[model samples]
Target: MELKPYRDNVGALLFNGAGLVLVARRADMPDAEGAAGGWQLPQGGVDPGEDLRAAVLRELAEEIGTDRAEIIAEHPEWLTYDFPPELAGRGFRIAQRYRGQRQRWFALRFTGRDADIRLDADSHPEFDAWRWAGIEELPALAVSFKRPIYEVLAQAFGPLARALASAAKSR
Candidate 1:
């Protein structure tokens, strides 16, 4: 079988003032995979000609119901990850269109209170539950296929995460 092109996507690593990264439990993962309740960072496809910055912010609002965050830093390079064969054509509608995702990740500082987050804000909620987690915990919490990307993110964003945590503690 010929491999398809990767889908253009954006990912958000929303860090709260306390320096914890936001993760959400997918509401639609297949139970057979035993990853039905797996957690992941907020991510979504980028529209044609849409700015990456805009796409990240839009995805944040659409997925978690808040755009009150501000961009702090962005991954210097795009990261690509392929879907595990079992997940191909079984997860997102985008799965039917592409082999996997080529994502531009961003670190955003959550500027609003937890009350500002509304999982039900969208007609179709992607996540059933959300929480702030330590950045190092991302890889283990993410699904197997997405683990590599989350691992890279944890390293790339480590210093920034630490600085934010320090700032929060000082306040």
Candidate 2:
């Protein structure tokens, strides 16, 4: 039996031309690093009545300050994770009211330069820093609770990331 509804969320695994994925450190954890909490993908809640695709793009712009990306792939089904026991009763409304998040994951190919990523684009920014990480490095960089989701994403998108990276190398 579930305790509460899962929050509707969308996550973007943004790949740069070199096939490196974009990971950003949330503002709240500006100095955190390693598996306990370090970096995470660009993702956010889906607003009421908004399309998932649009939500992903909006989240990218909101979280990392760029929408210069093209959707290349999507996970076949929604994936979910639960909030850690310690955080479940915290003040965060999502954790308080939801089991975790039911996410639609998108793979996006970045078409802009590194300079285009400006975390300050939003006055109230979610992330304080950003970097392009190897796809395999995602799970290790994420918070522990989100590591399973990140691992699944790395597997689902690994081939595509490698292909894109190789293509970039050939040119």
Top candidate on TM-score is 1
Candidates' lDDT values, in order?
0.91, 0.88
* Best-performing candidate as measured by lDDT: 1
Relative to the true structure, candidate 1 has a C-alpha RMSD (angstroms) of 1.6
Q: State the lDDT of candidate 2 residue by residue for 39-74, as single tens digits.
A: 899899999999999999999988888899999999
lDDT of 1 by residue, 35-153 (tens): 55689999999999999999999999999999999999999999998876666546566666677889999999999999999999999999999999999999999888899999999
Report clashes for each candidate as comma-separated counts: 0, 0
Model 2: lDDT equals: 0.88
Clashes of 2: 0
Candidate 2 residues lying further than 4 Å off, grouped into runs, are: 30-37, 88-90
When superposed on Cα atoms, how far off is each prediction in RMSD? 1.6, 2.5
